[model samples]
Target: MGSNSSKISDLPKNEYLKKLSGPESISENDPFWNQLFSFSFPAPTSSSELKLLEEATISVCKSLVENNPRTGNLAALTKVFLSRTRELRLSAECQNHIFIWQTHNALFIICCLLKVFIRELSEEELQLHFTYEEKSPGSYSSDSEDLLEELLCSLVQLITDTPLLDITYEIAVEAISAMVVFLSCQLFHKEVLRQSISHKYLMQGPCLPYTSKLVKTLLYNFIRQEKPPPPGTHVFPQQSDGGGLLYGLASGVARQVGSSFSW
Candidate 1:
């Protein structure tokens, strides 16, 4: 068995991909899927190898998203990938520029997948997405809510923990913009507004830390830049028309702050 496994592992990258991309659908319980889940890329010894590994991972992710037999399994896999990519980004050991670039690329792909998943969700599913078990004793599980919180927390860490010098301005803008779009969702926005007024808090408990980090980063960058954009320039590329996502985000955050200070 060990010899056979070694032989399989030694297969060329193209062969490996061909095998994995074969017509058989991937079930969560399938051995092939499990093997892929457990597979870790060896640390790249060269820039070329790093690029190859990154491309391979992207290919595999696209294939899984397309061919996975279960939505739940795909969601679970996405969560795992997001968590791993976050860990990699945050790791002090992962300081290589190529590695960091690859990590960001992986994050971009994962975010795209997440966007597609959210876009396809029905209104009923969207409602359920925000429902989570209360922290109180004997409360029913709210796995979906838990997952959402985890993702938010991860994004915050990704935004805050990564050094500004290391990350591209475009990626930084997109990350914060994504958060803004998420918070702007009607259901999420109403819930946050209610929480702010009733509980005397601006953002939800899980989102507060990230929100603070985001504000700090934005202010810091704005202050430190040699030349700032014109007064009305949008922070993100897609927000050129109106106040843009950043303005909306700032307003939302300011409201939260105001609620906090209200007597």
Candidate 2:
């Protein structure tokens, strides 16, 4: 038995690290999981540092979901990440401009991980997970449903809550484009249409109003060179030659909404 224990201890470092980090070893009370909530990437001066931050973020998200499956642990982690992102956004506003890029990178990475997590579930599982509704007062609420709602709400807040002038134009466009991509996810699309949550959280939330302002801003800038297009004609401008980021994001949002209800 002692020799067997010695053999197990002699396992490769990578293998041991994998075991230690596996979801099975994770718990709601674990310090490692708590640390993930407070984890902040240092200002990345090089591509390598940025890459490390991205990898670490993804690994934490992946392990949480994989180990905990549909448990409250995953939901808690989702909330933590979203809260941290919001804090980072506020920090970026007051700090150096480099933090804006860092926040953008972090948001993009989180969205990518969310997309992967959604795609990993089967259609039936997706439906079951997302379609769940709260029943009795004392009944357990579905963690999957909470996770999905929190993610969508976080994206909405990220785009709509920030002051227009504080966020870079590139970051604004990227956030909008990311929102479009997230809404276009197969499971998310179906849920929004069937449940009408999109109308509640997006179409009527802040996107339409924000997009309208964006259109006006873009048109005003364009009018200096040439006459603006017809009032309604440019509602969702195409990204043709010389068209800008606002146009591209507007087109993406329009396409996403149109496609959601068509099916």
Candidate 3:
């Protein structure tokens, strides 16, 4: 154990980051996972240190997405990673840790990476990526809601429950950006997202700290996502009714700008 510690400590930071982030295969047994799971801190305080840590997290996640081009393989890996967030208890509550994402930017990094994959991957590639798979004719091991929705709720908690500033502030803005991605891509679970944006926590934010940027992101995406019928033909209404709430969120933020309230 001491030898392993010395080796990890002796390695230059970039080399360590490169090792895991490189084309090299990083199994769960890799020391990288051990290090992430072992490191404990109340919040990420070191800018250079945590920046490299967060970057490493992003690299692994992106590699996972890129490596698993097949839908079946991606879904399998996606379910495992999402489930880890819950199993190890990642949330906005701000407790200290033994889990992989307990550090400051880690959870936010995960949220952002997930947004990238969800937006970039094809719909069919991700349909089963959200939740569970059946083992038999009619039985699933669990009936829990989509893990993606669970993570979305966790983002809502971070946005609403935590005071955004510094790194946390940056995280909040980016989290809203991620939510916009979910909206434009229309890849979210309806009921869970409704739970995320319900009137209960609208006061938490998407205003002030999140005001103009949030509104602009939503509005731009809303317009970009628009699909008018050819020439003068009437279009059918959306069956899934996916993104209406997000549009309302944009209008909601627009109404809150320059309110003269301190965040």
Off by over 4 Å in 3: 1-63, 66-102, 132-145, 165-167, 186-263
Give me the displacement of residue 200 in model 2, in angstroms. 5.6
> lDDT per residue, candidate 2, 91-191, as tens digits?
64785455554445445444434444444554344334333222332234544344554556565565556543334443454456456545555544345
Worst 10 residues of 1 by lDDT: 1-10
Residues 1-263, model 3: lDDT tens digits: 11122222332343433443344444433345434333222222223443443344555556544443322222343344444444333333443222323233344434434544554555444433443232332223346455454445555544555442222333444355445444433333333334332222233433335444445544564566543222111111222445443343343233222111111
Pairs that clash in candidate 3? 165-169
TM-scores for all candidates: the values are 0.46, 0.46, 0.37
Alpha-carbon runs more than 4 Å astray in model 2: 1-21, 24-66, 70-73, 96-102, 120-147, 164-174, 186-193, 196-263
lDDT by residue (tens digit), candidate 1, 1-263: 11122222342343434344333433434444333433223323233443343444555445543444323344443454465555554453555544444444434444433433343443344333333222232223454445555555666666676655423333344455345434443333324343322122226666575677766867775555433234323222222444433453344344323322221
lDDT scores for all predictions? Answer: 0.42, 0.44, 0.38
Q: Which of candidates 2 and 3 is the stronger one according to lDDT?
A: 2
Clashes of each: 1, 0, 1
